[model samples]
Target: MWGLQPFYIPWYWYPCSTVFGSFFERWPLNKLELGMPRLGLLHTGIVLLLTLITELFLKQLGLDLFTTTTGPTFAAIWTTVGLGFVWQFNMWPFTELSQPTKGIVASIASLIISVFLYLVTVFLVGQENIIQGLYWWFNILWVQVFLMAPGLYDGISLWQDVPPLVEEQQPLSLNSEGR
Candidate 1:
């Protein structure tokens, strides 16, 4: 269950970027040409996989690192590092910014967001209410879906009808006048 926590945050963060970007015409993964929600799901899936693997590795190493006091902090740091790499590798390459500028900005932004989320989680879901607090956090994350309304509305208006594919003709005609 703890392994699943990191997965929830990205669902909120990415869609927020997407919904907001739709209004401003600025998207995070613009090169992919995918909907922001779709990108968010992909991002969440990747983060979840990495987080679970890292957790398992730590457990195997007998680190005993995820005490209540350390668990959120570790989660935040892991989230920051994971997202920084993801944005740098996946989104940054497609942007107009220079490599160093993009890398530094992305790193700092990821760290800030991770720390903010961590602090908010800690405040709202104090140590005694760990499970309950996580539940609330998950609930808050889902609120991001509401941000998709404008994008969805615009998409509805911009919907296009695609023509059906025509079947290919045989190379040789069955009833040719010339042999």
Candidate 2:
């Protein structure tokens, strides 16, 4: 239970990017001397493994209770905080902390932010209406997240390398031998 994603999808990219992305950026992972390719692979692996483990943990424990009670187990807030850490604050105060400890601190901070946002929403909407037809919220959130998609940034960074399409005068090559 990735907590109310469409069809209860657990491997959703947003939450994984938000939580694991920031977590890995801290301490020991950041200290690694890997180049761009290796670092990217490591980041991908860390996010995937953690996301799978979290999905298993959530499903095993039936964390769906947070679904009806709170939206996506406050995943939206976690995304907000996680993105804020990197894009906005550049992971400030936590920068001073050591490796694993920094990661722990960042995790705790995100959790705190999630809880605080949850409380604020509950206070405003009241407990009774927490789950009442709020699907639109996530729909818009999806688009918002899409605009910030990591691939877009990568493409922008590598714009000079983007391949151009074949010219109309260039006939198609049907096979390896150019038959």
Candidate 3:
């Protein structure tokens, strides 16, 4: 199951291997925003196409369509998630993302949040047995590969526009009417 197929890999996903390309062109590792990804109509269509192509490729690679039983299929999802995070980090391997302590704290926090969200989504989707496993696969692979990538990029770009943090004073007490 670990064998790499000799077929040509998809062009779009390959750019993740490069440093500058991955940071600017691919999805950022941390998801900073908490709402709908700002994909326009044309971008949405492209992402859907890319996701379908990736799913088909995974199916071709012998991933189980029925995920009811716990086996290689479920294991693959965990493996991919780990690999994805590692790969994203590798994009800046020689450089520090931030101070070591801050980076470690952020990394640990992000991992916890990611795990909690996955469990929540699976429960909310009403997935059970094999379907739950499939949902994991879909979310780990296609969702990140396509949907999250574009959305994350938009978020990072938008973040630049946010005003800097400023300290403001607050009144001690107030009344409904004049006081």
Compare the candidates by lDDT and give the number of the best one.
2
Q: Rank order by TM-score, top first?
A: 2, 1, 3
| TM-score on alpha carbons, each prediction | 0.34, 0.51, 0.31
**Whose TM-score is higher: candidate 1's or candidate 2's?**
2
Instruction: Indicate the residue-level lDDT of 69 in model 2.
Output: 40
| Among all candidates shown, the one with the greatest TM-score | 2
Query: What TM-score quantifies how close candidate 2 is to the native fold?
Result: 0.51
Point out the higher-scoring one by TM-score: 1 or 3: 1
Estimate every model's Cα lDDT from 0 to 1.
0.45, 0.57, 0.41
Better of 2 and 3 by TM-score: 2
Clashes of 2: 1
lDDT tens digits, residue span 1-179, model 1: 76753434333344233322322233234456787789768756644554455446545633223444334443434343333334323433424655445544654455456556655665776756656655554444345334322333331113344555787875785676634
Q: Give the per-residue lDDT digits (tens) of candidate 2, residues 140-178.
A: 456656655454322112344568776457567989887
Tens digits of lDDT, candidate 3, 28-90: 323334334553443445444543554464455443322323223333343344335435443
